[model samples]
Target: MNSSRRAQAIAPFHVMDILARARALEAQGRDIIHLEIGEPDFPTPAPVARAAIEAIENGELHYTPALGLPQLREAIAGFYRKRYGVEVPAARIAVTTGASGALLLALGALLDAGDEILMADPGYPCNRHFASFIDARPVAIPVGPDTAFQLTAQLVERHWTENTKAVLLASPSNPTGTLARDEEIRGIAAWCAKRGATLIVDEIYHGLVYEAPPQTALAQAEEIVVINSFSKYFHMTGWRLGWLAAPAGLLGGIERLAQNLFLAPPTPAQFAALAAFSEETAAILEARRQELKARRDFLLPALRELGFGLSVAPQGAFYLYADVSRFSGDSFVFAERLLEQAGVAITPGVDFGAVAPQRHVRFAYTRPLPVLQEAVARIRRFLAERRA
Candidate 1:
């Protein structure tokens, strides 16, 4: 039997495969320090969890309007108003299953079959797959540490072809954890606006920032679509809830796609996420952010001391994309051996892109400080033993 060719064209999630191996090792009673996955080790904030419990008890799980719960949409808008001082009408927000759902809706509404969406390489693997799912091409612009692992206006201009449709970028990006500077995004938005191309910024890691707070694309350009989540900063990974804030001109098509795609996002998750923006929850998340920041600080220097080549400091999110070329020629082999021989798990850069794939690996600082310290000690010993 044959499956969809689209399914065939896409590659497997190599990180997940490594995770499965790690889990198998764990089941066999091996201790694995996981710096591989991007998920926050922290659970959902207590208030948010309680909200889900209450919603479930009340049986308030009915299908919401395809666009999402109006109150939640307003809450998201209100959040922008308070957090970024940007006024966004609730109607322009589409709450979907997750960031992936938001991406699906935006890509569906924006790109034609042959359209090309531009993004930085060494990016989230799912972003390109999301474009592929719609039969649109995702053009990867190779980015290094000089521009902080982000796309510059110049690179975007150089990559623009006749089929180019839009640009998608994530500030506090997944693998690298580097930000697209506010000025850089503004310049990209202006260029895209001039060309009549859409700019979609994935600001999911907004609240998770460690350095200076990142200004939202909505704050910079009123119409550039921004994708966000209750997952990362809110620490609600399993909730499967996120939102897309699009401009009024594109909301109708996005709404239609939302209506048909999944009927609505999980109802209970929406109810639960309502608590995510509250002051009590904010305090809790802030504390977790500090914990993550501490972990990042500890691991950054430790990796460098171990001879890892990292060009830029990760300003936000919980990842460090380190070049492992000094340690081994192939990062996949290095990652696998680290997991198997040293009981440490990290993601190979090949999972992110074809550009200099063998040279890099990403480490997530989602684990607690002590655990990270232990991982470092283990890695230090592993390198010493290998070199000896």
Candidate 2:
């Protein structure tokens, strides 16, 4: 039997293929410097790990309420109150199975068959796929350095159609590491409100911003849905825990979706995440964020020196979306050759979207400073040899 049409329509996440190839090369004795995946290199903080161990030992493995444990939800709300100075009530929070689960619940709650959702091209690919899963149309608006590779209220207005039902966005977005300005977020939220359309903002990279403090979209508008994960800033990628804060009106529907789709998020993970907001964990996460910022500072100029066109400097996140047109017309081929010949693994832009993707590639500065330096050096030699 054939798979469903929706399953067939989902495009493969090409970075995973790049990662698998990189791993194979490593197994065959090649020194692979991974700049592809967007996961942090740091381990989960001590306090968070200890909490998980304690929970496991105490037999705290029973299923929690589908919406999540009451304490964990309150902790997430407290994070918003303390971190972003926004008061999100615990009742509005739903601890999800990673941001992916939150995205599914949000889309499932908002979209119906034949609806349309607007988002930026070269955005996180899964946003579109999530819409597709619901039989909704995903309209990708092309964005570039002109708008910091982000969506704006004006762009949303320009792209609005009779069938449009929602808008999805990410600050400190993957593949680009660019953030939408706070004012821009407010504008977009207002626009969506005026139209009675839903707006979902991915804030998984919230605490990882450099140059200035990060702002939550919830601060822009109380009605907006905010999705966050412990995976990024907390260095807990493997834990598969995330959460979403929705308006009080939407929480009931989201809870129903969460109940049916997820049953509940992992019990041990929920317990462990309680410590994610602790002061001790905060210090460790802050140090890792600084380390990531330094890597970005180094890789940005190094890649530019090697002839990659990086028009916008990323202010946060651990990725640099570089235009590789000068070196190679096709980013996928460039990435493959770089991996095979130079032992450096990066994601091709095609993985993000179809907006001039052939000319772009993404570098995730998730590796250490010295490892990034070595990747840069290898690319330098590879380019020189190709020129000769």
Off-target runs (Cα >4 Å) in candidate 2 are none
lDDT of 2 by residue, 1-388 (tens): 9999879889998888889999999999999998888897899999999999999999999999999999999999899899889899999999999999999999998889999999999999989998988899999999999999999989999999988889999998987889998888999888888888888999988788988887789988988899999889988889999999998999989999988988999999999999999999999989998899899999999999888999999988898999999989999999999999999999999999989999999999999999998998999999999999
Tens-digit lDDT string for candidate 1 (1-388): 9898988989988888789999999999999999898897888899999999999999998999999999999999999999988899999999988898999999999999989999999899999999999989999999998899899888898999888889999998878989898788888899888888899999888888888787888888876999998889998889999999998999999988888889999999999999998999989988998888888888999899999998799989889999999989999999999999889999999999988989999999888888898899899889999999
**Local distance difference test, candidate 1:** 0.91
**Model 1 worst lDDT run, 10 consecutive residues:** 214-223
TM-scores, each model vs. reference: 0.98, 0.98
Top candidate (lDDT):
2
Error of 1 at 12 (Å): 0.3
Number of clashing residue pairs in every model?
A: 0, 0
For all candidates in order, the CA lDDT equals 0.91, 0.92
